[model samples]
Target: MTDEEPTRSAPPEAHAVSPRFAEYTDRLLFGEVWQRPGLSMRDKSMLTCSVLIALNRSQYLSFHARRALDNGLSPRELSEIVTQLAVYCGWPMASAAVSELAPVYAERGIGAEDVAPEPVPPLDADPGMELRRKAVLDASIGAVSPDLARYSNELLFGDLWLHPELAPRDRSLVTLAAIWAMGLQPLLDYQYRRAFDNGVTRDEISDALVHCAFYVGWPRAMAAAMVAREVLVGDDGEDHA
Candidate 1:
């Protein structure tokens, strides 16, 4: 962000990035490629967040986490993405990402010292959907791997889902997109139902999946749509009954 820092230059070789790697990744990749066309820097940063979290790139996740905030994403939103990604990308990565962010929060003055006492609770929002969401997650992932199932519940649901910054709708969208991009079809199917349980509309979920298709691929989008149809059917059945 400083003038002295080269905005479009390759990452330093001393940082273990080879000159060749720098050409493709740092210089051309970020500088020329990501900068080329229609997308704004803010949108690019959000995309970067999705990719980094999907790849479990802890170091880049930290780097881009700060950039995401600089581009207008909040700490709470970043936390939510990391938490949601844990369902697909795994928790060790999320933990590493949270570790990467602690200092950034300190520097940004996010704690009590920055804000006066408000009468409202820190997390005053409705949390009722959480229990229902757990049932969906339990059913979706419970039979798979215990480690994955446990992390999805304990860390993502218990910790990040409770963050107050981003709305549940936004959080669910990010979760759905991340899982979709990661090609975790089963989890995506489960999260499709859970997203509705958290009050996300079928239209919003459909739109998000559609928007992500170009980046994530038609196959993944089709799979997500199939799952979403099931959710809609289930809702209709409940309504008719």
Candidate 2:
């Protein structure tokens, strides 16, 4: 499928239960939020899949897995996203996402070999990586745990973030979605800002959280919206000052 095509199909039965919800889902979520020009379909797909994976919403993952492919996310990129989430979310959640996508991959002729991640280059190859890592750690938690800081730098930022299959912007979107789904406010607050730093605009972040409400539930999305608003407002204040 081409990138311009709609990744997700319409519900088989419209107004099957609640017409209001179906209309909202069809008109607002899909029509407006997803169609918002700030974020690409690929970006939205990655964000949606990451949230679904983090929440262990396996039933919905299959549809998104197929959608992700249509949206131009490679199988390898999707696999790497699951791998990254294993560390950030949990092993079981990531594992379930993989299991949920297996059939979709098979149907598309994406074998295990096709989805295997490429070898990550050494950290030194990206000279600025350490500097960026230290800046983030210093700003957020002050790197209180030596081991954790090392892991975050050498593994999370060094490897996963640097993975060539996905751009840093895409990685930031995925990370934000996972943290939001889990309701980790501190991380959500940090990641929301990080998302902006990684090139996700404030409006895109807002739209993404609204899109997530349907899949991850309203409570988590509402909580995340507050964090996003705070981060954006703080940014605006800084710009004005």
Candidate 3:
């Protein structure tokens, strides 16, 4: 099949179990939500795979892994995503995602030789940029864990974020999806702001939250909305997008 075709196929029994739900899945979720204009299918697929990975939903994760490949995400990009999430989500969850995607990669003939190494920026890449990134991390979570603050600077923003395989905007989207799906509001709030800083527009963030509502659940989405609202409106009540 061509890369454009969806890798997932609904089973006939799905329609038999609940016609209405099945219709919604096929017609609305896949047809409408997946076809939305604001986000490309590649972005949507990235979000889907990340959400499923965060939730530890192996079945759906496998499906979306194939779909991500079909939607134009290279195996190397997917590998980098897993590696990046290892820090944000957890090593176990990230490892599980990699295990689940192994067969999918094998199917596509993407072996270890084909997977690109994660890029490492030079130590002197930009001292000013590194300082700014450290300052942001310190401001956000430094009080809680100085080690975490250091890790965030050295690993997350320093290394993973600098990887050219996925654009910063797309990386922000995936990060947002993973945290939102896992219902981590404080981290979600932090990520939402970081997302905006990384070029994820307010409307795109809102759309992402809404899209996640279907997969992650309404309660979490609502909580995320409240956080977004608070972020958009500063302490002085000014809308800051």
Error of 2 at 33 (Å): 3.5
Instruction: Report the lDDT of model 1 for residue 237.
Output: 60
- Look at candidate 1 and tell me the lDDT of residue 16: 68
Better of 2 and 3 by TM-score: 3
Question: Candidate 2: minimum summed lDDT over ten consecutive residues — where?
Answer: 1-10
Q: Which segments of candidate 2 are over 4 A away from where they belong?
A: 1-19, 119-146
Models sorted by TM-score, best on top:
3, 2, 1
TM-score for predicted model 1 compared with the true structure? 0.54
* lDDT tens per residue, model 3, 1-241: 1224342345688788987677667777776777777877787888888888888886778888888889988888888788767877899989889888888888888888667774555333456766776887798789889998888777777777777767778888988888888888887767777788778999888778768888998998898888888899968899987
- Candidates 1 and 2, the one with greater TM-score: 2
The lDDT per prediction is 0.64, 0.77, 0.79
Candidate 3 segments exceeding 4 Å error: 1-9, 118-144, 235-237
Which residue pairs clash in candidate 1? none
Candidate 3 Cα deviation (angstroms), residue 59: 2.0
**Per-prediction RMSD in angstroms?**
7.9, 5.0, 4.5
- In model 2, what lDDT does residue 89 have? 92
Q: Backbone collision count in every prediction?
A: 0, 0, 0
TM-scores of the models, in the given order?
0.54, 0.78, 0.84
For 61-114, candidate 1 gives per-residue lDDT tens digits of 667777888887766566666666665577776787777777877788776433
Query: Could you give the candidate ranking by lDDT, starting with the highest?
Result: 3, 2, 1
